[model samples]
Target chain A: MIQDRLRTRMGWLHAWSGFVFGLLLVCIFASGTIAVFDTELTRWLQPEVPPSATALTDEALEETLPTIRKLLERDEKPFITLPSERDPILRVQYHDGHEFLNIPFDPGTGQELAARATVGGTFFYDLHYSLRNGDTGIIFVTFSGLMLLIVLGSGIIIHLKELIPDLLVLRPFSARLRAWLDVHVLASVPFLPFAFMMAYTGTFLHTRSILPPVSYLASINAAITPVAVRAESPALQKEKTVVPALPPLSPLLHDAEKVVRAGQVGFILFLPKNILISRTDASGPARTREHVDFSYDGHFIRHVLLTTPLTRTQQVMEGIHYVRWGGAGMRWLYFISGLATTIMIGSGLVLFLMKRRRLSGGRVIFRLAEGLTVSVLVGFPLACSGFFWGNRLLSGGSEQRTQEEVTVFFLIWAASAVWGMGGCLMKWRVQVWRSELGLLAVLSALLGPLDLLTRSGGTVFHTPTVFAAVDLIALCVAAVAFQIARRLA
Target chain B: MIVLCSVLWIVSLSVQAVSEPRMLRIARREAVAPALTVRLMRWVSLVGLLLCLYQRPSTALFVWLGSFSIATVVVALGWAWRYRGVQRVRRTGGGS
Candidate 1:
């Protein structure tokens, strides 16, 4: 009787917790899953952006400094980041309230090109991290993550009976509870390490929010600052009154390489008064900290080494998060793990509503769950498809390109929500799922060919790396859609 | 020894699943049984030791140590609660 009571309590906790936060958790996971390959997606979407070759020794700051200085003379604090392997544009960013005025420069000629916004990549990034709602979103996500930790704990406790026995078992034809438990175990067990790390790191990420009162008491300035200040140093006054002619970038680059002992210099930043060269070692995988920042005024090296521990820690954290130090194999591992996390969260939500429907015999609750399932599972993909569609449809030189993209996203989402509600009214959960998946497959398959035909620069067949990846992912989506359609039928 | 451990595990699970009020008292007692606690502690320690051995003197060692420390704290809490419960029962002369 006591054991039965304990089981009841556990079941109650699981059901309530899952029902309340499942939908939001699914959104978070799906967005994050897509954002894992955000960079690749950006490249595939935008074909007009020109790729940069390695900056020649001859085309150093001596050649480029004048152009940069001339461009930045009017701005208060101008900065340039030299093109690296991932991004090949010499990006010049001028801070404007919460937004950046980005000017892409030709690495070879040092000529300023037309500015392009980073809305596509930035949107997905922000959605994953902040959910585009700022502090409220952060709080919601953090709370959901905490709840997830509890859910996992309770799940472990509840399934202690069959945990070991059911490790590899997937009873596809079992009752709803049994099937849900099987999926929960299957998804959770394989990526247990990832789940634990995500929880720990996620808590750490939201530490400021969790312990805000304490954090505020500890450091008031840190709590307020938009940009974190790493180091405190005496500002270098302009010693040379005259606008001194800058030294050639080749020598500076050579000197930086010697100091850092790196194979090749990635980027050379020409400040109005100083030149910064970012150099990384060839032996190790790409690390942010490995890229040494050197501030030089022509011949003199003002700052040789990083003076801030905070900056170093931040670099290491970025390195861990970005997995830049990990090669293709490690990246693939992270990708697979992220995919599993998405599946785990998505399936968990589905299971929650499924279980709830069994308990609550009301049509209202069932309809709500069905609508939410459709919105989250179908709406997210449709919104992403619309983002691509917006990119293609919007004129290249149009001022409202960003606005158009956002509009497309909202419109698709709203339409999906309506469609989901309508489907729920008709009790067409399986039919809606099948239909939406089919739509996704058709849209995904068309994306590559559309890009090839519409874009001037390159064809999908020619650039096998970018184009083939898109095609393959699309094909996978199509296959999944076909399977779902079949299952539904 | 393996048979004994498996029997203890099964007993703990059976205790956990009982729903009658009298059975619950027995179950709670079994849940915090010295034999069960010792077995759990040993398994946890073994896992920790193996991890520390595998990734000796590294971050993994620290992780094992941390988990062990947490388990120790949890066991202490469980013991304290059990002791309090027993004292309460003694005072009330097994009323509930």
Candidate 2:
């Protein structure tokens, strides 16, 4: 009797929790899945930037830093980022007034290249983490993660008996409820560990925001201010009295290489007397903070470890969330887990409508559920595809690219919502589902070729690993749309 | 035997909640006692769990002991409440 009661409680918890967060969870899952290959996506988005044929050498880095330093000193505080295998251009970021400037420098000569309107890869990085909405996005995503934990826990309780029996079950003929239940259980059970890890890490990522104010108070008292120090301003130094003789960069590059033992030196920045060299370790986890610093004129300084033990712990937590450290096998595992999460959210939403249909026994509730399902499942994907379309269609160097992308996203999402509502009036389930999926498939498939034509083949065929992966994903989505269309037809 | 029966009841209740519509119907039928008591019990349990998590117990031994003790008490209370409600409902319905 007690066991039965406990199970009942778990069922209630899971069903309601999953229903409430279903839409947000779907958004998180879809966005996060795409974000897994954020770097590749950026490369695909911007194919005009040619990949460097020659590796950036220490001598080249040394020669380039002095000029970069002089330019950076003239403007705002300049922090130079050395290029890696992933990105070929040396990037110098500085602030002029409220506006930020990201100037790419030729790695071989240290000469300033054309200033880009967008910091291409970093834009994707920012978008994935915070959606460029800052703290609001973090709070929203973290809350979604917490709700996911509740859903996972409750789902297990509700399906304990069928868990083992229905491990591989995917019944296509069953009623909507049964189908949804099968999908939810099937997707959730196989990737329970990965889901749990993501939830825990996601919660940890937003610990400061979710926890009581006392934690922040304790942080301040513990001598840990969250504010980071600004890099020395290039503009201030530029205005300062000229010192004709500047330090040579070769010695500094050599010293940094010795300290970091990186296979290649990507970029070097000299700020008056300080020389910063960035090294790349492709095999290990991505660490933007680990680099070698030196005094201008090649005097060995200390290796600047940007991340502390505490921060490293956070990085590892985020690494699990981002899945960057893992090899091809782990990447595939994460990909499957992410797909499962998407299915779980989608199924949970369907389950909500099924339960409502059973309760209401009226056409009104069914219509509402149908509209909601259309808006959430189909609408969100359409919005994302619009963003990619905008990237392709908008001319390069156009100041309105960001604005246009945002506009396309909002317009598509709004149209989906409106169409969903209208479909309810006509009771046209087949029409709604077919049209939405059809449009999505068309848009997604068009993206690859459009990218090829517009952006000089947009990395679709650049490297086999990336090209095959992206093309395969796009094809699978297209297949799903076709299947849905056939069913509707 | 009582504990085993209680466990079985909870398990059955959970499965019924998912698979059968009758359990929710029954829950709705019980106007006050079962519905209200279950909700109150849940809130109390949730609060206790939150407190335990927030404190961050220093030792593994301490955590194990505290968790076991809390679980025992919460389960006992929940089971007792449920048994009482069932008995009252049965008496009122005259063994329907």
Chain A agreement with the truth for model 2, given as TM-score: 0.78
Model 1, span A28-69: residue lDDT tens: 766666666665565555566664455633453344565556
True lDDT of residue A56, candidate 2: 55
The best candidate in terms of lDDT: 2
TM-score of each: 0.68, 0.68
Candidate 1, which segments miss by more than 4 Å at Cα?
A1-8, A50-106, A109-118, A171-181, A213-259, A263-318, A359-361, A425-431, A457-461, B1-96
Q: What is the TM-score of chain B in candidate 1?
A: 0.39
Give the docking tier of candidate 1. Answer: incorrect
Model 2 quality (TM-score): 0.68
Q: What TM-score does structure 1 among the candidates reach?
A: 0.68
User: Relative to the unseen true structure, what is the Cα RMSD of model 2?
Assistant: 14.1
A396-468: candidate 2 lDDT, tens digit per residue: 6877565665677778988997898678657776788889999988987776676567644345447444544
Instruction: Give the backbone clash total of model 1.
Output: 10
lDDT by residue (B1-96, candidate 1, tens digit) is 222223333343333323223333422444334456544443434444454456433233324433332232233234334455554564467835
